[model samples]
Target: MRMKHLAIVAALVLGLTSSAFAGQKIKIAGSTTILPIMQRVVEAYMKANPDVEIAVSGGGSSNGIKALLDGTTDIAMASRTMKDKEIKMAAEKGMNPKQVVIALDAVIPIVNKSNPVNDLTIDQLQAIYAGKVTNWKEVGGKDEGIVVVSRDTSSGTYETWSHFVMGKTRVFPGALLQASSGAVLQAVAKNPRAISYDGIGYVDNSVKPLTVNGVEGNATTAKDKSFPVARTLQVYVDGSVSGAAKGLIDFILSPEGQNIVEEAGFIKL
Candidate 1:
């Protein structure tokens, strides 16, 4: 009878473990620029499919990809493409990352709303960020020192800016480095002499967007590839993800999800 009881208890333990494993919640992380959009998408998804559960958070594009590689997150949101080194590392770990494009974006320059400067040529922007142009007057603005605010190295926005805007140069050491897009927005909004760059979605009445080479960073311009800094917003997954994770990815690519992307101030794919 003692042996019979032991068998029953083992069966119960196995059942409980299987149940818990099957019910694990889907986790999404990375890219503060994509966090707001994912939050809204998650809300809509959960409301429609009440049985599923998902958790979303932001660190930055690099951290998100790292989370995926470490098996901590099911989805990794990124504003920039994964670097070759990252891909090689994932391959070495036997994880093949699949990229999915969800939306389009423009990494546009921004300044305090009170600033008079409206447009900047790419050459002038390079000079300012390279620490060559110290005063706003050099770029057609007031004669005040330009306070440069930049996203930190881990940020996908910063990657985009470095590749497209800074080119062969780098942001000067004196520039203030912000951790997230929201932080960058707030830093520029609070300081009249400050200038920064962020995904177009983060722009609000609190800060003014600057045109590049006389072309604006709007949906039309981004879609047509005329926006110089425009890039595809994407997510990365390891191997073939199914169940709740795949469901969430499908929702993001669906028409309804794309609509939410546009509503969140990004261009729909």
Candidate 2:
């Protein structure tokens, strides 16, 4: 009789544990830079597991980090790597931040379709954006002045270029700064002599990407590590995360989720 009672207790405990897990839901939030790719993963995962409620938000990387620290988000999707200040802030709050590189992306240099230039060496790109090579004629295009376009100063993509390409130099004056990658692509598409940078996933036939240091934007260059401006897309979470957050991370790291990331034009890690 004691053995039967023990079996009954075990079954009851398992039932309650399963019920608790099924009852949970989680919401994730993060930067707009990875929205297109992240959205694809979230929607598909939700469909497969209807019990899991995955909500996404886009308020820039800073806002995402803020949400994570405030307990408003389960995960923070950041385009750029985490900053030292952000990491230190989490530590002070007893929140351990962990990162996962979901995929790789490129910071593509784009020019208007009508523009005759096909590629720009790194030096030429810097000079054009620094107001040194003002005219397109200097770069084998029209005689008109080059219109420099850019993302907002707060943008991760902007920060990447400033550090890697511009090397802390100020951009050329009269440059137009948009707030998002989509906005940057749109602005470049509209301007005949405009040049801008955006995440490579945003690149299409609408605008052409110029080579940096003679390395083209292709799969071979990416695999061989010749692509100069590529960066990793990161997902961050509090170290104590469990239950729903843990499950969500598993889903993202799983082959199924990575497949979605790859299909969305990112290099799945």
Candidate 3:
């Protein structure tokens, strides 16, 4: 009877150990635009559930979706909805991409703090990016030549800008392309004649955000759809997510997660 009791106790201990060691882990990758809010969500979630492990990375939205389809990541963060081609590509790989809208973002055009140009009409913006308006003087600024800073093609922000601001027109070849919003901020902040566009969450006193068609880019404007450059922020999962991935998604859509989104300067859904 003593030997049987000891065997039962050992088995219980081994089972508990195995369960603890097999705790869920999830991988998330994608948009720099969504990085700040996602990081905060991950931090809070990890703190609440110490057993679960999550890895987050930003390599632009395209790379994130690619990682998801490639089976390397459980979640893909994106600022724009998945393209039909991307959806078809995922289907070919036997993966169904599901999107969860987490927040709303406004892509605000920014210039140096010293820039005197306060607002730009959509037509003027289109001309500026198209290289037709090369000098600041033409747009009611200094006589200095305009230095255009743009996001790389891999960025969802860039795609949105191309669609709305550029009117499907390609950015001039002379524009300087940066890989992330932070880089665009840094470049514009230092160059008085430089102009760029980034998510409103990234705008601070370091740069001046331009009014689009007399409308300001803010959470209020974004929510009302008055902001012309607004886009929805989302996270993509493979069909139905389970375990850690689902937990993270659930947390992001929760009240606490929405609070984090607002605190990060994004508009909550």
Top of the candidates by lDDT: 3
By lDDT, is 1 or 2 better?
1
Considering summed lDDT, which 10 consecutive residues are worst modelled in model 1? 15-24
Query: How large is the C-alpha RMSD of every model relative to the true structure?
Result: 8.2, 4.9, 5.5
lDDT of 1 by residue, 1-269 (tens): 99999999999886654343355588899999999889999998776556667889899999999999999999999999999999999999999999999999998999999999999988898898999999999888998999999999999999999898899898999999999999999999999999999898889889999999999999999999898999999999999988777777888899999999989999898
Q: Can you write out model 2's per-residue Cα lDDT over 172-243, one digit (the tens) per residue?
A: 667888877888899989989899998767888898788887788665666566887778888888885688
- Each prediction's Cα lDDT score? 0.91, 0.80, 0.92
**Candidate 1: pairs in clash:** none
Q: Rank the candidates by lDDT, best first.
A: 3, 1, 2
Best by TM-score: 3
116, model 3: CA deviation in Å?
A: 0.3
TM-score-sorted candidate list, best first: 3, 1, 2
* Per-residue lDDT over 18-51 for candidate 3, one digit per residue giving the tens place of the 0 to 100 score: 3552479889999999999999999998876677
**In lDDT terms, how accurate is model 2?**
0.80
